[model samples]
Target: MSLRSLFVDFNSYFASVEQHEDPSLRGRPVGVAPVAAETTSLIAASYEAKAFGVGTGTMVREARRRCPGIQIRVARPERYVVWHHRLMEAIDHAIPVGRVGSIDEVACELVGRQRRREVAEEIAQQVKNEVALAAPGGAIRCSIGIAPNDFLAKTASDMKKPDGLTVIELADLPHALHGLELRDLCGIGPSMEARLHEAGITTVAQLTAADKHRLRHAWGGIEGERMWGLLRGAWLPTAPTERGSIGHSHVLGPELRTPVGARAVLKKLLVKAAMRMRREEMLSGAMAVRIRFIGHDQRWERDLAFDPTDDSRELLRLLNGVLDSGNRRHPLPGPANATPLSVSVTLMRLVPRTQSSGSLFAPTQDTRRVDALVDRINNKFGYNKLYFGSMQLALEHDAAPMRIPFNRVPDTDSENEAGHDPLWLQSLNRFKAIAEGEHRRRERGGKGN
Candidate 1:
């Protein structure tokens, strides 16, 4: 077998982008959080912060304790999406990008002369150079991994640090991976590790050496057999799975922890999810809402099944009913004293929207016109230009910017255009101005008295 795939994984993606956009943050410990709250957890941490035992999922206060001088930045999803496109173009100059594994990872297929080890290494170097040149101030870096299959290529990419390149050849097979732990592989996590241990496959070597049948039995499915193939440098055919659901979750900031605020967030989430479902031409028959309270193990959840529909107003009504039921079953303490940490809305039991037929008792509201109008306005003016009145409270708050999932890229045509909406630009500028003004105010206040 030869080198067939090249994978590039961005290092400390969000933090690196922050540093790239701002020169002063280049070497400082930076932590990116979804919200500007001390209690929120870091979604990404810089290398400088990592040295002090800070990482994703570490609370902001703990990160500050670990690295006293750490700078915390609220995440800007739009900025990350912009950088993703730039990096992809940079890599495309070296080799046609075969697949975008996620926002922070891309893979290219090596063919013909490119498959040669020397040529592959040269292309990898070119990619690194291009990425540095494309990024603002040359602050972004990536780790490149060349292997016979995408899975192992991704695995090799994680073996090193910023701006590192590693190759896993067929000759290196099972023994070369013997020193690595079970979790070193992409799909193996803590739970998977425990299962592997139960199956007498505690090490990478043991996992690679196990029979496909035994592995399948251990996994209770065919995924183990696929893993067995991937471990041995086999390039398996890709199979696409239908999307099962559309959902969104938001981690509430300190100020928006009340029951009313949580409901507002849930409303916004449902609207977003419904919009996406309509865009994808999918209809959902069931909906569920979940709420997690701060510092509490118990969670509140409720689910309801209804006639399949993609109408946002109808879905909102159903979702509100679910929330009301949940409140009655597990009443929230007063908004003043109790805090809900997060809320999620999920739309499940989906089918093609085209398959949905009109119901005899459908509400009299002109949902189709309302939805079409909302989509048109958002498409022209940017997201959240026209939203439900119920979501007014959470409108100013970040609707928890959507993150691109590992398997897909978001629709970026309008967002990536040169002449994107001026309204969105104005909003961004206003936010920046307010932040800068606050910083200056703090500095002047410190200097006084």
Candidate 2:
């Protein structure tokens, strides 16, 4: 067997980007919270913070108890997106990037002489050097793994820590992975571990020893058979995937934890999803709204099917109707009555614009054309500069992250929050002058058409 993959996984990507952007944060214990609130969970923690028993999913209050001096900052996703694209460009210069696993991880295929152990190690070092030089403050770091396949390479990458490199030759085989827990493998979660345990495979050694038929029986399908091959470094094609939905969710601050606030935020999220769907030249046939309350598992939700449409106005109207019908039965409580912690909206059952049939009851041609026009204007000037009035409360609160789909970096124009200088993002933005008076009116509190 020969080496076929080199994987790079950035360490504490969110916190590291914070330190990279701010010179004062270097070599400090840092935690990144979605909001600057104590109850919020930490999304990323620096190595120093991790050493102090503070890490991802550690609540801000608990982090302070563990590391009193930890510098917990609110996440700035727009800046992170900028860094993600820059690193991608820099790494592609060193080696052709194969699969961008996520914003913080990438896999590259090795060919020819590059598959040699020493050559692969040298290439890994080149990636490290390029990232260090390209990053602004040289604060970001990564762990690299060289192995015979993508899954194994990713697994090997997780075996080490910040700035460490590991190689797994095919000769190492199942022995090299025996020490890892069932969950340590890329796709094995608690549920999968339970299923494997039920199948009498209690350990990685047993998992590797099991026949394809037994593993398939345990997995309930061919995925198990596929995993059986993947364990021994078989080159298998990844399953094909397609976009099923477009959506966004946000954890609310104290002030916005109300029924009114949730409605406003959902409106904004739906608009954002609509814009993204249109960008993909797709129409949505369904819409789902969800409201998760504070400290509870119960949720208020609705999923409605609709005629395919990409018009933002039609989507907004559908959202309003859903909420209205639900409210008549069981009214959403206000902040004084009950706390609404978070809200989400999704557009589903998507079909390409070319495939959508004309809706007889839908509005004139300008309905869809106006949405495209508004999107272009916002991209040119700034996000929310000409948005619908329903998003007013959300704009005032100003809370949404661009890390919804991990692999898709923000366009950094209309997809980003306002008040940032997105001039450096010419790839997605072209500054154009819109009609001055109408945009100013929209900003001045007009319910835009």
Candidate 3:
């Protein structure tokens, strides 16, 4: 078999982007956190910090203890999204991107002479060069891996470091992967590792040795069989899936951890999610809310199933009921006391607007017109200028800002700009068109030829 896939993984993506932009952070231990509080965990860490046992998921205070000089910076999601787009545009010039695994990973399909080991390596080098030239801040490095299939190529990419290139020939098969831990492989998180261990798959070697039947039993599905084949360099095609849910989660900063503040942030996230759902012409059939307390071991969660609708008032009313129930069961503390650390709201069980036949109590034409008018006002004025009254405190404190996720590129015009000028908004809409187009191309060709 020839090398058919090439994978690229950015090193400490969020932290590296921060270091690249700021000269003082270069060559120093740096940790990036969503909230700049000691209680918060680092979302990304520079390679220098990794040497001192400080990395992603390390608490800010713990990181400071591990490396006294470590610098903590708040995450700038907008900058990361901008850099992601710039990097992708540059890499597309080098080779065709087959799929985007996440914000920091990309898989490319190689054909004919490009599949040869030497030629693939050269192309990988070209990609690195392109990134360097494209990045305006500094040299943004990446690790490249080449293998017979996308899975093995992704595995190879994880085996290296910043700017490293590695090749995994088919001849090596499972033996080449024996040295790595189960968690090092893709899709094997802590929970999956425990499940594998229960099935006597404590290591990569044992995992590879397990039969398809055994792995299926362990994984409880065909996903196990896919892993069984991928270990031997077998190619498995993956297709893009339709969106099943829209949600947002935010880690509250120290000052915004109060009960009132938590409610406001959650309200903002829900409204933003609802707007996005309406933009896609979809209605939610169910809503779920989760609130995690700062010091409590137990979290508060509530879920409700309702008639499918995109009416914000209906959704808000349902959400308010859920919150009221939770509050009655367990009273929230005062502003100075322990409160929610993070909150998330998800709108799931969705259906297209065309398929949704409203019930007797569905929102009326007048209500629909009002919602449309509100949407127009926001589009013309600003995203947060005319938000629901409940979200005012959170909005004033700059909580629950819009963020771009891996699966979807959000509207930059709505989030990035302060003024919503018609001409500028049109230009930003064009930029969004390009971004959404790029994301769709990757989605269509996910890990498949």
lDDT of 3 by residue, 1-449 (tens): 37899999989888888888997998999998765578666778899999999876676787899999999998776677677778888899999877876667789999989988889999999999899898755537899989988889999998889778989998887899999999889888767999998988898999989899999999999999998998888878676888898777766777887778888888888888787788779999999898766444456677899989999988889888887764364444222245566777999999999988966789999998888788777867778667789898898888866565435444566544311122222222323333333333443466356
Q: Candidate 2's residue-wise lDDT over 349-423, tens digit each? A: 999989878477765788767988998887788666798897788778875534435335455555555212222
C-alpha RMSD of candidate 3: 9.2
The reply for model 2, stretches above 4 Å from the true place, is 136-138, 327-330, 333-338, 404-406, 417-449
Question: Could you give the C-alpha RMSD of every candidate to the true structure, in order shown?
Answer: 7.8, 9.5, 9.2
Q: Candidate 2: TM-score?
A: 0.87
State how far residue 155 of model 2 sits from its true place (Å): 0.8
Backbone clash pairs for candidate 2 read: none
Model 1, residue 9: what's the lDDT? Answer: 93
Residue-pair clashes per prediction, in order, are 0, 0, 0
Q: Give candidate 3 misplaced runs (Cα > 4 Å).
A: 136-138, 295-297, 326-338, 414-449
Instruction: Give candidate 1 regions above 4 Å deviation.
Output: 326-338, 363-365, 412-449
Estimate the overall C-alpha local distance difference test score of candidate 2.
0.77
Model 3 residue 32 CA deviation in Å: 1.4
